[model samples]
Target: MPNHIDFVATLAPGIFSYELATGGQVILAMDVGTLVKKGSDVLVSTRNAVKAPDLGKLKQVVVQQYDVLDEREKMVRSASAKLEASLIRRFVELK
Candidate 1:
């Protein structure tokens, strides 16, 4: 699939998040909960469709188009930088 190409894998103990783009046009966020690789059986929590939200699981699933997520990340990073700067200023002012 197209997503496989731009997919970035992140593995955190007890949680895993994978980012991919569908047909190189849409971004997909796949979160696998409680993954276990047995001798022969592999378990995964996945949505049924790609384009829409799948309420098949209890945990919240988010899938944003590639461009949307890029924008969000930029905004988040920008806000974070501003917050950090403010925090530092506060600390300096206290002294």
Candidate 2:
């Protein structure tokens, strides 16, 4: 099994992005303090591997720190969600 998985979370609106390996140590190391300071909404994007049934444990870890959204819910909240899906694709292509 892979020790780490790539996933995206909606931390803010203006594209505050960063990639740091948790080293299989922490499930989420998001700076909630900074997020609070920035007054950004916390919404986890469930568009990809994040919805895998095999990742239930991983999802649990994330759910502890942030709310998990299903596809239907995501569509309902589309106005507030950031465009991390496309951004991530562009990033991966760049790499």
Best by TM-score: 1
Which parts of model 1 have CA positions greater than 4 angstroms off? 1-49, 52-64
lDDT of 2: 0.42
Candidate 2, residues 1-95, lDDT tens digits: the string is: 13334434345322223333563322333332222212233334322322222344655745653454465577767844556667778899999
lDDT of 1 at 27: 32
| Colliding pairs, model 2 | none
Q: Report the poorest 10 consecutive residues by lDDT, candidate 2.
A: 31-40
What range of 10 consecutive residues in model 1 has the weakest lDDT sum? 49-58
* lDDT for model 1: 0.48
* True-vs-predicted CA distance for residue 63, candidate 2, Å: 29
> lDDT at 73 for candidate 1?
94
Q: In order, what lDDT does every prediction score?
A: 0.48, 0.42
